[model samples]
Target: MGKCKGLLERLKNNESIVVAEGYIFEFERQGRLKAGSFVPEIVVDHPELVRKQHEEYVNAGSDVVLAFTYYGHREKLRVIGRENELETLNRKALQMARDVADRTSTLMAGNICNTTVYMRDDPEAIKKTENIFKEQIQWAVEEGADFIVAETYSDLGEAMLALQCIKKYGKGLPSVVALVPHSKDHTLDGVSFPDACKQLEDAGADVVGLNCGRGPATITPLMKEIKKVCKVPLCCLPVPYRCTPEQPTMQTLKDPKTGKQAFPVDLPAHTCGRTEIREWAEEMKALGIQYIGLCCGNASHYLREVAEAYGRSPPASRFSTDMSQHFIFGNRKDNKPYYSETLRKEITTANYK
Candidate 1:
């Protein structure tokens, strides 16, 4: 929680936003909640890709860079047969960040996601998540992370359980819990936003915010609801992936007969990219949101655009020469030292046991 406070203190100065993001695995576009064996070329091997994303956000003026481990939550990895490699995967991701971040003031929070699927329906599912998240928090703390964000939680009970794991094994690491809102204006499991806020605050969350699901336009209304009931700083990490009834893509496609073989189709209203991120940040500022960030589709340039807007300036382009100087993706050669450190004491009562 104290680590999260580092970003909070900086916000009190002037227009400030949390330059943060979602977990980017190699197979992000492979499927929704896909549990197949991870392709080596597609995952942790590309730490440089992850590092650059974080650096670009920092350069574009993000205050925090989350390690790319959202789904690294132990139980989810277990679903894909890589559960035992959790420690190795986590340690490698953080090291990648440590190498490239030199310019801006940024901190690294280990990210713990909800189970690949919500675990609210089954008691055993719930217990599995509790154990996995607790292990993630401790491992992140040991691997030199700055804080923790238990994010993308749909069911309130699932979120509450994740928070419980953090409180139990966080070893005093500061944390923020990102809650997903339900259709009736409550948590997916039927808890009101205000009520969920109270529980998180009671459990000592340093910052509470929302991400994924809703786009920027819908988020403004949602932020208002959170502001009324929550008293801590808030972060907004939305998804970068686009969604439609059947597919989500950066560009919708159509066959072309002429110049280029293919081109993007179109997006209906209620969905947009960069423009939507700008509009959403502006709305949050109006609502007195102290912490600002992007979740899903935004890259570092996108984050910088959001940060520049927070400062009341024009959004910086990703290719501007100024950006070249600021974005640092770290030192990623074919080989680098790997670490195996554990930040927690025995889960005296092993959830596994």
Candidate 2:
């Protein structure tokens, strides 16, 4: 939103694309990582060092970097003793992002995830979540975030609350809201696609889009319909595969894989169809996502494939291995050089195995 006008122009231009990597520091289902206390644990114990991963994504031709603060909401941090460190943690994430974005003109999108949910969707939970936006947004501005993305929302209520908070505080910053595509193409609130976009538009979101779903084929018709009606800009995010979160990232499969262990697919898991994935990319470009990005199932090679489809070549130095076990390493945002003694010593199959 600041000092990045040319960058924004590139994005605004025809057929532009960007990719976001990771839920890295985020807590998985049911909020397993307890707030502040677990930040270090999540990073240190998560097996993958995210910085290097972010860098790898950037190398794969991604134009934007997403901060790994998806679960960094105040409430989560409060679960741990580091409620006080909320600002510190959020700011550090921005700084880490800045460090990664520093090398190239790549932009950083600060996360305001966890804004949408049900069961916990009542007024009380919403109020607590609002405070999280307040804190994180303030820190993001202070730490120089280029943009703010409230991703993976299932409903519009949390979005409304978040937008209300933005009006109350965020004077001139640009914001993005990415919805999860569910039944009827409405948010979990039953707010229809048109209605959701309008509400989010009214709520001060600069760009509105959809991400984390069954891939492009399932999303194209709705997206086309959405484009016909919406006034603001459009963005699109697609995963590498259609089936499982841990579905085989074949192009993404790692030869010297590190991070989480992969499991057998027969046991009920996330999976994405490759045909669907390729079609999704082609259709998304056709359907009009000035900014195109690949989500979870994406690896450096996967992104390179998408970029090539768009007539663009991948930037040099991208490397990623899909999980045969469990974890997949994303863009290497490690500010540290790979030639450094520490990296050379630490990056090995023996260490992880």
**Best candidate per TM-score, number?**
1
Q: Which ten residues in a row have the lowest lDDT in candidate 1?
A: 261-270
User: For candidate 2, what is the lDDT?
Assistant: 0.61
- Write the residue-wise lDDT of candidate 1 on 48-109 in tens digits: 66666666566667666676777666665676677777788877776665444433445767
* Candidate 2 wrong stretches, greater than 4 Å: 1-8, 25-48, 78-85, 116-123, 243-270, 273-276, 316-353
Worst 10 residues of 2 by lDDT: 259-268
Error of 2 at 300 (Å): 2.1
lDDT of 1 at 304: 60
Off by over 4 Å in 1: 1-5, 11-15, 23-43, 117-123, 182-184, 240-273, 312-353
